[model samples]
Target chain A: MFERLLFEAPDFFTYYNVIFLLEAAARTLGMTLIGCTVGFIAGLLIAVLRQSVNPWTLPLRVIAIAYVETFRRIPFLVIIFIVLYAIQPLMENASLLTIATIAICLVSTAFLSEIVRAGLESVPKQQIEGARTLNFGAARTLWYVVLPQAWRVILPPAIAFAVMFIKDTSLASHIGVVELTFSGKMFVNRGFSPLLGFGAVLVLYFLLSYPLSRLGTYLEKRLDPSRRS
Target chain B: MTHLDVRDLACSYGSEKILKGVTLSAEKGEVVSLIGPSGSGKSTLLRALVGLTLPSAGEVRVAGKAVDYSSRKSVRELRSQLAIVFQQYNLFQNMTVMRNVTIAPITIKKRPKAEVEALAAELLARVGMEAKHDAYPEELSGGQQQRVAIARALALQPEILLLDEVTSALDPERVNEVLDTIRRLTDEGITMLLVSHEMSFVREVSTRVVMMDDGKVVETGTPSQIFDSPTHERTRDFVGMILKH
Candidate 1:
């Protein structure tokens, strides 16, 4: 395996193959980034909706709860297939990558919303009451008091989900999205040694996720209230 | 019109009644203290007054205007006129002492930033927390945080202050620092409704002391009257039990 990998290394390092792999890596990173970014925002909105006790938000809250609960329980791969079939008839020009990304967003939103909900709930009730009694309206209280405190609790897990999600984007390969994993399979199918092909894919995954975990650590320290002067 | 009038204010947690038709009133510039054993609904009354705990039934009027707790506008208006200090300090742990003091005034009230900060600085100094302006709540002692909490409430320039066991969470030695801060405020003429276990301080600063038991006001009198010559058996029993210690 080592000799075969060494022999294939030269062919694998060609400019065209390198660009192909790089593009695949970019797709993976792009999908995760766009999906998780949209997920975080949508998840935060859902979490806040769920937290609200006002009678007016009951329907929205129920819909949000249903979305979070339903999507969270379904397998991501099943969601990808569902999104793929679901989108095909709706739009003629929709790309496989777009469908895969939508699936990623749907699942991540469900998971991340729960993480954010926990983070929001972690803020002591007294803090909220303090804000309420101080005339900090719900939005103001959430912005100034709750979110700032919750970030410390929210960042670690949200970033962890993002990192894990970088790997999970490989599932998109089944839908012909040409992400990192599919790029590896493509190389294997093209007569390259499996070790060289998959090994390169492994390296790209690390390159993508390492910085994210580091970012999580950096954010955890930066946002830590105890660390703040 | 009374500065604060709570008429038959009742509240419940689920089925358990916390404040049962408890009527109380305070005049402008009056320092009224609620003294009671634990679970006597003293804190709940203050909570209800600020609309923190929704009253199951009853009415609260501030300066001749009845507060409609169901209305967001009414609650917001009531909160603008009233500020509360919780027993836990609840000083936004994420912010520095200065931000905690000035945030609501600057952001919520849309007050001028400089003016709010200047008032915050003065209030922090008044609370003896001048040097810790940039310190987070976790960095401060419980008493220090409570002082910051008081300054935070005062920066709003509330017409009435509800102090819910401000010193109850402090250490025995730390209680006086907070008590002294309230001592200075008592004469400054902010109508304050406080619930405290500090009997001596309550007696010393309260213009009138309300004795409560089982979610009801057993008696309302001058501090000396309730402490020395109580009229109700429950008040006497409570005052006797607490004063003995």
Candidate 2:
């Protein structure tokens, strides 16, 4: 099954070669890793800031909500274009990898933030009340008592998002990030056995994303209230 | 000074009043039970005292310091002085009974972990939950959860406790264990405001009983006065309604 790409493809060990494809896969994986790691941190900050219900956090809450809504509503492709255009004035020589990374990071931040917010909401109010009566002020209640429970609810969706985000990283190729899709395009330019070669790209994407989704499914069952006991 | 004081406390959600101009006080060692029909604002009064629901008008003084519920710091200070165990028990589902009891003291009071753990063990023993210290809330029956809830509240070393229907959610067979726990707690000299449907238990344990109707305290007296020979017509009707069943 795996022999065809190495032995028979027109582009095999050629201009659009195995080494190039390997390098491209590395770039795409790197972009996804950066996007998800940074996105999760930024998103958690946004989600926590958004849940705060005091005058001090109101402005931050507004900004967090606006970012999530704005990014979630806009198309990812358009986000890359807009980000490229928006940053052109500030950083005139911005690299494609940089633009693609930022765009994906912001997009994932928006989604990941909402996922966390929903998880926070899913935590029953009783849990929070229990904390409050214990004299744990708002922040401690949220961080120590509430969030640990919320994380069980947050994990599956957050991992599922990773699966979608990995496949979505191929969209980076549209802005010339030289990632997986770009590698496939380079091979397509070689013409012979394009079907088989590009089919390998689809398979590669499936291979990368399938494990994440499977893990997420397993986690969802593991987090089931019945299973928790 | 009274351990807990409420002066003309009134709380409402929107335009609808839950507790209306209710005033009460508890001397240390007093177990004052609030008895009334459902929706009589007994729970609301406890909720107000615990800072779970802020009173729209009136003052709640914990150990004589008037609490400013509008201020988070003030409310936290007040909450530290008076712990509440709710009807649902509300033990942290993610935590074991020991963690549930120990977390508040460590987090809110910043007590040394070793000291808090010692107190947690002691409180669990007081509530007869020593064997189940490692158990989670889901593993326990409602009565056992309420006992843990009591221990958790007690671990805060609050001068007063507010119990809102603590035994109402328990099974018939399980209710006695929780009532026995509360009976022991009253002997510890802590002030307590209890809202309970367990009329016989209330009559047996309460130092004083306050009868409420339609969000107002209709009468307040010794348990025998309130139960055996109530003065107010509303109190009589309320007690009669519950006792007949």
Measured by lDDT, the strongest candidate is 1
Candidate 2 residue B196 C-alpha distance from true site, Å: 0.4
Residue B45 CA displacement from its true place in model 1, Å: 0.6
The local lDDT score (0 to 100) that residue B67 gets in candidate 2 is 90
Interface RMSD of 1: 0.8
Give candidate 2 misplaced runs (Cα > 4 Å): A1-16
Top candidate (DockQ) = 1
Task: Residues B116-174, candidate 1: write the lDDT tens digits.
Answer: 99998999999999999999888899999999999998998999999999888889999
Question: What lDDT would each prediction earn against the true structure?
Answer: 0.92, 0.86
DockQ, computed on Cα atoms, for candidate 2: 0.82
| lDDT for predicted candidate 2 compared with the true structure | 0.86
User: DockQ, per-model, please?
Assistant: 0.84, 0.82
Query: lDDT per residue, candidate 2, B1-245, as tens digits?
Result: 88788889999988899988998888888999999889989988888877888789998887778899888889878787788999999999988898899887787688899999999999899889899988988999999999999998888888888899988888899999999999988888888899999999999889999988888989999999998899899888888988999
